[model samples]
Target: MNANMRAAAPTEVLRYTAFSADPDGGNPAGVVLDASALDDAARLAVAAEVGYSETAFLTPAPQGTEGAPEGRAFTTRYFSPLAEVAFCGHATIATAVALGERIGPGELLFLTPAGPIPVTVVGGDGESGPRATLSSVEPHSEPVEDKDLTEALAALGWARGDLDPEIPPRIAFGGNDHLVLAVTSRERLGALDYDFERLKELMLRLGLTTLQLVWRESAGVFHVRDPFPVGGVREDPATGAAAAAFGGYARELGIVPEESRFTLHQGEDMGRPGELTVDLRAGDPRVHVSGTAARIG
Candidate 1:
């Protein structure tokens, strides 16, 4: 059998919601604990069947994949219903918490396409579930080209005047590229009606993972929405990757001070209502995102 199609039997896939203790809230991800025997095709098939925004597949370290040890480390890959993503923050958090439940919480390393991501999972108390914090790869943001920005705004059904003059448009990267567009009011952020296919086309052309639609509620609080047409999801309830990227953007823009921590409210409009915490250290460039997750099924 071709390696990509070789599979002995069906593997167990766990369902978990990331960034929320309540099973009905947060972003749901399908977790395959042992995918060593499955090939790319099989993984894709599994993700499609699960029908989550993203599904995480964990396999023993493959040749050329390095980090930690045999049992302590794994090569993790994320797949959406339609395609594979370089990294997925919510899925990573969910996977870590799931592993913590089985192996006892501590530190877990993932060898991902983006790079090695270090995740720390805290064991859950009886009442509340486990929480995981994942430190992103070094983050960076750059000015969005005027033409690209214009195209994005048009696709979002937004005009240049609709944006917050303070938070200029930028392309930010934590693990994946996200176009960060900050609006002047929460009303604007909540009223999200866009040209889906047009936005998807532009995102695919620019290699964007999601459009980070944001509104600043206060100095330390914000509301965020992610448009993830590229991933075959209209919107993600809670997006850890975009949160990290936005944290980097805010710090770089001096909108928030260094060594700052903030709360992000997401999925409110969709009724999922998940919360994510983002932290930045004085000197460290990488962003940290923390949230709690629970098993759904």
Candidate 2:
């Protein structure tokens, strides 16, 4: 792996979690610290080899000083195994913690393709180690088209009667756009079965990043499972992108307090459990998603 990453053409994958401390928890991501040297094909190849849901690529800031820039900032781009993604929150968290390891815990300013994302890394060493929290870009939500909503439900093998009317469907954007669909029951959320190719096709046509399937467990808590066929994944355990989108969706619909902190549990059915904390500011539209990520290996 070192040879692959440092042999004139450097591209190595460093594993880290996105939303939890335990390696078994959180969303896993691959990080390539020096992607500045690689071309698009090389970078994509490296990501495909690394095999995480997504990988973060770091390049010299288009406009900034070298050697970690001001406030540990750098330009970043994210890519899945198959294609490039505009932004990825889980990968942002993973890369922040990875940077923290090399430079010691502190704040990292990630100049993402979507926008500038600031991440703070705190805690680390032996039994106790570093964890990261990322504040997302400004979030916003819009009403879901009735016809589109019905199509989405049919795609997921769900019924209109099974939806939570209060949360109202919406297409929300935090970093990337996500379709927020709230199921009336946890059982409906858990019994996920969809034609992968069909969903992928539909998502591509709609320019969607993922499908946020959720069930509100309480006023300030929710359970989520994301169908990411768009990214060639069946289900995502913990999705920081969707969490941010969901936060915006909830607030836009007056379902939760304007400034509130909430919990999201995902991946229980798949058995790789993860917990994500979503924080909304009183006047800010950007939702902050917090979690601790450990090395997958």
What lDDT tens digits, residue by residue, belong to model 1 across residues 75-126? 8999999999999999999999999999988888888899889899997777
Cα TM-score per model? 0.94, 0.93
Best by TM-score: 1
Candidate 2 per-residue lDDT, tens place, 130-200, comes to: 77778788888887788888788878888899988887788999999999888899888888999888778
Q: Which stretches of candidate 1 lie over 4 Å from their true place?
A: 1-7, 62-70
TM-score of 1: 0.94
